[model samples]
Target: MVLGRGNFSRSVAFRWIVSYAVILLIPVALSVIVYSQTREIVEYEIKRASVAMLKQVKYIVDGELRQTENLAAQLTVHPDVRHFLDLKAETGASAYHIYRTEQQLKKMLAANDFLKDIYIYSNALDSVLSGETYASARMFYEMKNQTGTFAYEDWRELMIADHAGQYVQLPVKNKEKKENTPSYIRSFPAQAGSGAAGTLLIPLNAEKIKTMLENIDWVKKGQVFIVDPNGQILFQNSENVEALSATYRKWIGRGTSTFTDTFQGKKSMITIESSDTSGWSYVSVFPVDVFWERARAVRTLNVLGLALCIGIGGLLIYYFARKNYDPVKELVNVFSLRQRQGTSRDLDEYTYIRRNVLETIRERDDMKNRHVRQLRVLQSYYLSRLMKGQTDRNVPLAEAAMTHHLSWTSDRFAVLLFYIDSDEGGTTDLPLSQFIVSNIVKDSVEGRHAIDFTDVDGTLGAVVNVAPGRADCWKDEIEDALAQAYEFITARYKLRFTTVGSDLQTGLDGVHQAFLQALEAQEYRMVLGEDALIWYGNVKPSEGSYFFTVNDEMILLNLLKADEFEKAKGMIDQIVQRAFQRQTPLEMAKCVLLDVATTLIKSIPGPEQAGVAWEEWRPLKRLLSCATKAEFHQELHDIFDKVCGVLRSRQTAHAGAGIGDQVAEFVKENYRDPNLSVSMIGDRFRLTPQYVSRLFREQIGQGLHDFISQTRVEAAKALLQTGASIDDTAARVGFASGHAFIRVFKKYVGITPGKYKALQ
Candidate 1:
């Protein structure tokens, strides 16, 4: 778990997420700090702005009130107003004075919007005049019906009598929808002892003032309302006017106050400023969020913006991280050629990758060395076969060289032969002696490029490359190198060496002839009073007129397979004896006998059939160890006896039990016939089809049908190697059609017949 976590933590995605998250978090942190720090500053700024607006409204009210008061003063001092007040009797002159004073009042009221109406009354004349009408009685409107500017009681005290020292009024309840206008009334000219003539009264247009306040859009969005000291709403463009006025009045104690109040979770800033001239207060309460609603909007935008950034950044990081890791994934796939196993969970990626890299490098090196060694072995074997006149017609020498990556630096060649003659204290083992002499000869002839082989018994041979037109130039140097080899062998192994250099030859056939000629010269080399040959043919010394043909080998193997031990023994004896008859230089004689021994050993059915493994009999090694001709012949006799004895035992064991052995051989012989089936075999063997199928399965370890198909497929493979056409091969191998041949061949060989032929 710890390792898994460590690998995860080190991953590119994890690091990318961390990096991008840190970048995105910077804005989030800054927004939080900025939002937290700006609350008070916003409230203070809003309070100042609202207060300034309130002061401006207060000034407008005061100016209007001052203008009305100036008009009232002008009315008191006017000559026409004095003339009308001085008269007491009703006459034309009094009527003329009344008309003049009424004209003055109408003109004054027309010039100012703040004045609703201007009225003057005198008790001596028992009349009242206003902009709209003239009243003959001192109090034109009755007290019970009075509702325009004042009550009758207030009219009696101020206009009819001089009783005013201080007057205070509150908003009066009215039956009409429009609020009642307040009037500024004052008794005039009574201070100069002229007696109280009349009073000038001016009513204010409260709706006009309210309309002016409504035009301000900024304050209208929140709480902007006018309130008197009694907490009554006067002019407002907002909802819940009474409640909001009361809320502000409850917190405000004096002319102006800036304070904070919170209800529920919503906190607000209340700014209230009282107007001295109007005896009213302008109040506005703003929610804290509203005070900085712009800042709030900015904060909201930042949050949404941050969320979008995080989303985009996450995608970008994932894309870039996966793109970066793609190469690593490819490397993993390359190294892990098979599917991933559960065992890999114990290792981290880096460690697993490192191990796979090292293992792959080692495997590549091993395969390269093994391939080079296999190619060298093939080249050496091919050259040896060519020397003994066993070259394949299908495989040209140039093609073989190209296929094996062999480079031939020279066109000329010659055979250099070394004979290992065993001393009294030297080794008698044929293979060991050949091996030692081969290594010694290769090392001593250091500068020359040679293809060396230790195939024949007791002889080490090399086909050394010779420069063209300088074939004789190599003889003296080769003799000197042979002297060195002879010295080295005598000192180390108690062995004597003899050398023979064949005449220089040209081309590939010339090289093969050179080796044969060198074999021919070995006798002369020994004849020159040199060391005796340690090993010759099993029967005798070489007599050149000897050969073992393919017919000779097939008959020998068939005899053993048929359990004809005596015939096979006779065949082996005749072949060895003929191969040794008057041997020329021990080349063909040794080559023929060894070839027959190897073929018989390879054809020993299987380990179970003969009760003989390669390790058990080791026929080739034992035969090569024979000290005399008779000993060599006895070893061959023994090997053939064991192989034939094993086949004979199986035949005898099955003879009483079943015809499995006979059935297996019959299938092998008649498999080329496409109609040959289990029923045909039963008819031929005089048995039932079911019994024949069971016997074939029990003996061959496969169904009778599959065994015949496989047998034909095997033969088809040999035919394909000899460069036959696919359709011809299918017909020759008893496959019904080309398609069936391809399908069945692929079933057995994992590739189509055409593909297999191409590979060959």
Candidate 2:
């Protein structure tokens, strides 16, 4: 049945469903057909490519095997090698000479990249020469003592057992031989007058051969193995290959031609067969999936291409349907004009505002320019007073301003300067509108009073010279009035404010000093809050010492002892906050804290126990560079915690070595000597006697002499080696007299010296 558009259109839902199903099925059916054909082509191509690559690999591998065989053959014919074997046959030859010859062979083998190991076996000589000679005679004797019959099978068995088939054996002979016949195993009898008499068995370098195989570019990424004619794998790269399988073992002996076989338990498409020249079979494995993977990619591409074509056809139909409609052009033209007009209006308003603001600012700036020279004079006078250490007092503003030819005799005022933190966005190029605001506030305040206000430095400050007695009264009134004005101004125009109130001062002399005090007061706001009004009188003089409470000290001590860095940091922050509240000089406070921390770290344990080298500890210079007190405290806390952690670990590791115990043991063992001293004990332990003596005195609460003397007198009575009278024994045990020893002995031993000796 043919489905017409009119009939399908009438039933829209059914029509779309059927159309979509047909559209989807068309690509799917075509994809199935194309996938089958393309898969076949890709599989054929992959197989062809793999075969070509295997051929190339075989060519390279075969060439390497031939070269190795040639090298082995040369060793058999070498005159030095032949002479060594002949000498080895005689029992009179020294082993050292044979060892020297082996070393020479090793050097030659090392120079050749293709040789893994080279060994010569002489049946008549009854000796085997490995590539390298042993330096020790005992080692040489052990190598030369191996006993076995001169047969290739013995060599093969030894190699296979030793290395587990990671090595290949190559036996090169001038003639072929029958199995089980020793006569056929004989070497090429010294040609006429020549003297070569040994068969050489060399172990092939499997990795080198594999590398050569890899250079072929088509060998695929897997193992290439070589096997002997005895159905044994002579060499393999991986241990995963099952050596017990008869089929795997038989593949090696299957003649000198290429064919496919499974290897290493995988269904590998391996090219296996023997080399006609070497009789060693090599297997180059090209996995089956290498071909199948190519087929999969081709199938995917064919389906994707068919779908792309269908999608393009649908897009073309949509494009033609849209082209038949109209009126997008006219609407676009109308909107374009409106966008242009809006842009022009924006530019016009921006330019007009910018011009007006710039012109008004310039006029205000020009009028304020007359005060710049006066401000410079005022700055010089203030700086002079600062240099002379009169910072707390004020510079007289009227006297300084009059010196620069400005009349301020009738004006009465107070100076106020405001600072605003820049926006959270970042520093913008807004040239000090806060300065303009300060001027506006100053003008408003002056307008309320009969006073004159002058800009100090561009937006940095303003100077107001008020009447002498009125300075203190107007300071508060003006500050409160201006603060309200500032709050209004900043709210009206988005900005931030920080105000510094100068101390009361008169005229031009104190004006400059007052301006400086105002500047100093602003610095206090960092520790104080934002938008803060800091006054000169409110600034406390720093005592230069932080009063940490007993609890705080214990917290710090526990942090250091337990190696808790975060807790230490928090404690330090609290300390710094208290210190800053007291107005400690930031630098001096930082130095004091760092010094305390360094002392605490050093006092934790000996440097070795601490595990921190003296050089690793943070330097005082680095601590001092911290701009804020809290930062310095944190750095100190971190260093102390690290030092303590190292100390705790070291203490845990060497809990046994207590100096007090060591001293007790020393005194107990050596108390018989009257001349014994702390110096002798110190030398034995590699410590200064002064240090040891101090430790002993502290722990025992007595001098080392009193302890040693008391113990020695008691030991003397027990010593039969001092076969003398009790008085002589007492004298020998560091006593002035026998009576004194008897007195001390009775005190410690609960008996007189003579009676103690009689009991012994």
Candidate 3:
């Protein structure tokens, strides 16, 4: 009977424990799942809201950029602007012209409060005229010295970087006023001619950018920055600008992207938006915890409830087991003693429950660890895609990263690169060498720096997550770590590794840009040599003047005239090499080479030998469509070789025809039409105007002008004899004005047009 009662109590205890566990776990699990979903929803909504606000900010910033571009375009077409830029006179007219042009520019400045000042850079005058003040020659030169020719060269680079894009230079302190001015530059004439007209600079109001960014309260809670195509931080409205800018370097070309990552040891979210016009990116950063703080309370309550349920369930199981097992007490004690011999038997009844609980916790933790590992792998792949500028479906990527437990939304990033020199000659095994390098770098920077190193081919690329307030010394820290790595690798393997790193960027979007910049810095290894940590700040844009000088043409002509074909070829190569070295616009380089070709043609025996025919050459035609420096250089060589062959054979004899007679015949046949000028004649005959005029006068014993005038008067006299009106005669004979025609007719015939007509 006692045994039967023990069995009944044992059954009751087992049922109660199972029932209580079911009652407790259901609510806790549901709460956990619900909380996780809620947190995700909240983050998604915040990202959407932030993106919408960023687009609005982008709209405002892009609108301002467009307005500035339109203003520049309008100024390019302004009558006074055209007149001032196209000025050819070097004497008395420039002062009045400069004054008038300045007045017009000043009026433009007055019309727009955003325009602080204007600079008109006249390449023809070799002067940069100011609209803000009445600048004399001395003042202009002084200003040029202060501003530097590098500024002008940079503008040219800007034009080349994007033909349709306007350039906005970073903030600079105004010399006259103790305030910052951000210069907006746009060159006149979208395409350059033989000579450039000038560049126009409008210093915009920087405060406007600040105001627009300030209105983005969500992003501004962390920081906001505008980055240009060249990776320049144009404007920022944050106390930690250095930190923010460092982060922005990573988001350079990211059109639209968002991710959650850590900043300053605190979790954060970052969003980026790019402008269609200027290619400037707008970046917004916000703390992550701020968006999910409410979910923490729900999780805490669920945890407490789950612990209470387990505690209550365990007590009931113990109570019922003791009450039900009274009859089987001896049997239970024997089993307990045997179990104690094998394991810990001091707390026998509850041991089974404890073992089961421990098993459940271990399984949960194991699953979590696996998920985190999977998330890291996904994050690595996403980072690669981001660096490659493939964030078109960024929302999905972010979701995948979040699900895997990887934070895709980092507010700041830095790319660290390790380039193993091909000629270092330490190891033939590339993978092993790369692995060793990565390990060394990782070991040196693992805990203190949050960075991921990936093998990008032979180069080991490290994409670092920059903590906030760390921008100032990030470079120093990176350099120090790299130095240590470098020493460690060299001492162990004797392999030389060159390290390069980009500036701190605002988001993962900048990772690709930073990598590119780091690569660019690596290229400078040709100039800077090896074993040095080359930073983005060390590599500068080419600042040399890109113009082909008169002396360069003279040297080429002298070589061609001397029939030194090899020397001429070398000279051609030099010209190409120098142009590319200076980073000259390919268009400008083409113009220079064509100019050289023209010089070669003119330097030949006579005009007809090289005239009209030169323009129709197949090589010249091919030159017009050539896209690269190599193709252009080859075309130049082909032209040079053909010219050299013609010189060698003396085949350019032109059938013994004299150029002066040809010019006379041409003028006699075409003089009746208007638009006839010395310059036009020179173009038709492939000769300089001065050269053509002097040759014609030498052959005809009078100036080409006198001969053309005499021919026109003779034609007008015949027309008058036919009873045509004075205006009709003037129009027929290519005279622009009837009064001028009448005067010329009277001067030649020694009478008025009517009297001359009656005599005829």
Quantify all predictions' global Cα lDDT against the true fold. 0.68, 0.57, 0.68
Error of 3 at 672 (Å): 45
Model 2 spans > 4 angstroms off:
1-34, 49-53, 85-100, 122-125, 134-188, 191-196, 206-224, 248-268, 284-287, 310-760
lDDT of 3 at 104: 83
- Please, what are the lDDT tens digits per residue for candidate 1 over residues 1-760? 1235556876545666678778877877886687676766676687787777777777777788778777777777788887777776555346676777788888887899876667677766666777767776533654212656666665557566652221224233334343445567677665346567666666666667877777764567566666666676656765454464344457546568877786334676677777666566777766767667676776788678768877887788677777776676666656567534553655544566787667769989999999888876886676677666677645654575576565555667777666657889999887788778778877876566544553643356677775445455676666666778778888899888666666777666776787777776555453232542211222224434436777777887776655556677788888766654433444565667777887677566675634473667877788776544456677787877677666656654654344677777888998888888888997797555765677677766789888888889999999999999889999998878889888999999999988888887
Instruction: Give candidate 3 misplaced runs (Cα > 4 Å).
Output: 1-36, 94-99, 136-138, 141-165, 168-171, 175-182, 190-193, 243-248, 253-255, 293-760
Clashes of 1: 7
Residue pairs with backbone atoms closer than 3 Å in model 1 (clashes): 542-583, 543-582, 543-583, 543-584, 544-582, 544-583, 544-584
Q: How far is 359's C-alpha from truth in model 3 (Å)?
A: 69
Best by lDDT: 3
**Tens-digit per-residue lDDT, 1-760, candidate 3:** 1125444434434555566667667776776687668877778977887788778888877776677788888888888888777775465346787788888877877877666667776655545666766454345534532343335455434433323335655334555534434567766763345544677767777776777677766755676777767676677876465644455466655557997766666676778887878777887777777766755776677678777867886687667656765644444455544342345333333444455457669999999999877876676666666666686544553464465454334467777777785445577587788778877787887656667766665567888876567778777787788889888788778788878777777654677788787776665554344677877665545455646789878888877765556788887788777654423444466677777667666655676455633655655567777665567777787777767777766633432247778888888898887888888888888655775787787777778887788889988888898999989999999998989898888888799888888877
Q: Which lDDT tens digits does candidate 2 get at residues 1-760?
A: 1225554443333434456557766877877787768756754665566556655655765676666656655665677676766663346556776777688788877877766556665544555667764223233223432233335445534422322112233343313421111111124345446444555555555566556655656544566566666656655555565663676565555554444556655555655655665565666566666667767777778778877867775675455434532243233334444342233322222243344457669989987887786675665455444323455534354554455454455334345566655545533334556445655675666644443333444334555655445654776667766777677666665666677777766444455667667777766666565666777776746555445445556666666654455666676666556555535654555545664565556546674534453556644656666665446656766666666677556544653346767787888886656556888887776555665676677766777767787678556765634557877777666666778677877887787767666666
**What CA RMSD would candidate 2 show?**
24.1
Candidate 1 lDDT score at position 405: 61
Collision count for each candidate, in order: 7, 19, 17
